[model samples]
Target: MDTPQNTALTRALTELPGPLPARGVIHIVIPHTDRFTVVGNHLAQHAGLSTVAVGLAVRIQSLPQGTEIGIKALAARFPEGEKLIAAALRELEAHGYLRRAVTNLPNGRIVTRTVFCNQPTALLRPRVVAQRPAPPQTSPPAQDPAPEPPAPEAAAAPQAPALPDVQQEQEPEAPAPLEQEPEAPAPAPQDHAPFVARVPPPTAPRQPPPPLPQPRELTAELDRAATALLSDLRRHARQLVLSENDIRQLAPAVAAWLERDTHPDTIRHTLTNDLPQPLRHPAKLLKHRLTVLLPPPLPGADDLAAPARPRIAVTPFQTCDGCERAFRAPTPGHCRDCRNAHAHGPAQAAA
Candidate 1:
């Protein structure tokens, strides 16, 4: 059926040239209803519908009925944004191509509904009509049940048999047996007075519990390590400043390093190495270093008590070029294992 909208769109489309020469190698189909064509073509010459507005209008006109056609939805599908879409909608309304009615539903909620039309009209604004609820349906009166037929008469009853006559009995029922009167129960004995409990003598008062041992104070060794770490940090970064709170926070991380048997020199080197040119956050830097580079724990006393074994000195050992493992070597070269593997290639099979 050609609605007013379809009629307007068809008239508008028919005015355009039949078919253009192939403009591009890839052509996409423009899917739209008859009404869409009418509305879109009518807006083609519209001064208010700029390039952006026209695009927004086309997107809105092509959407399926009941699909959300809001500024955000339009902006997502088309490059034109909420502002352009809003302007185009207003223009369409002014030109009689679109109508938006503010309606109050039966629930008393007010909402604006937009209606798109291809044909321009001078009709008045749409109004909200309060829906009148339908009247309750009355069930048809139940039909009276049909009358039942009368029942047949019942059969006649039989006559009862008669008993034989007996001689006069002189023996009387033992003089009407006399009913005996029951005697009231004797009164219960009165309860005896409650016995009094004997009281005991008072006992000695409780003594205070022995005083708990005082917690051990911070060790001198831990204090020294924390002080040394702070001093080294300040010396390395002259611009860095340490507050009392910062020192208090850094104490724990330093104590953790000490407990792990980390040497003071090693701790200083780890914390001072690779520091940013301008140290902005000293506490944070120290915290990261202490946590990330924490040394392993010390060996137990039993390990130290055992006999010592011969080991290569640090000066004689160097890292292997290929494997990066530390070993005693006279000069720079690959480790023996890596050398042997490299020599035995796939071409040199076992003989």
Candidate 2:
């Protein structure tokens, strides 16, 4: 049933490097000489990790040191939503592939440091060593003795005293004069005041607050509202007039605030209230407010409660055809009063 072309194709496929397997994952891998990531089978095929977590782990490992991998940064970089990415991060943490430490900096700022472990088991095991016997102690090498000094000259030596005549009587030498001892001066008056040491109180270590909840993705309607709100900030506060580029740059941050059920009025009040005097760099100030004061997402309804109903859209305003009165209706038509008059007029004429 095989033709000449098919036979050649099959032969070519068999000749290729890393022969194809009968089932599951055929790899025709080329050895990478430069940029590539090395992942262990335990991680790549981990039963505990979801596909997103595994891929995220590998990508994180390949990145250079000091790169930002925060929830916000990762959410912006990848197509995955923040909630899913957050869940994936939790999974990686549970598996011992990632660890996050919160530390209070000396400058009173709290920072989070993330550490990734390539070999989790190796981190837990204690190291072993083979002790070798100490080398035998040895004395230092000795140096040659210096030559002896030349003998002292005879002139430097003093002659011995002549002996006194044995027969002559020796008078007792006058007693040497007794020396007087010097007297000690009286001690200076001492102050009786008690000394008190002033020691400063010990400063308490600052504890980092609980982590803020991750923000949700903004919907299309919410994005438009956020952009409009930012563009209109100038009307509320003269100092907050922002350029097109600045608005575009800051729109996402504003959208994050709106995504959390915060009202437009509240946001406007927050940004415009108590602005600094001589405010320079309006864009930067607004950006700081948007980030530092972001509110948490609204809580979901209880499981036992019924789902909230969808909101009905308001009808568009239209002028009635019969009567020139503006009214709320989906389509142009006669107003209620006009319709009633017309209907009754025809019936009353017949009566």
The candidate that wins on TM-score is: 2
127-226: candidate 2 lDDT, tens digit per residue: 5443455555769979889977755775568877776875567999999999777556555443333344567677988876433223367678876887
TM, every model: 0.24, 0.35
- RMSD after Cα superposition, model 2: 34.3
Worst 10 residues of 2 by lDDT: 188-197
Distance from true position, residue 249, model 1, in Å?
0.9
The global Cα lDDT (0 to 1) of model 1 is 0.67
* Residue 207 local lDDT, model 2: 75
Candidate 2 Cα errors over 4 Å, as ranges: 1-19, 129-351
Clashing pairs in 2: none
lDDT of 1 at 174: 81
Cα deviation in Å at residue 308, candidate 1?
16
RMSD of 1: 35.1
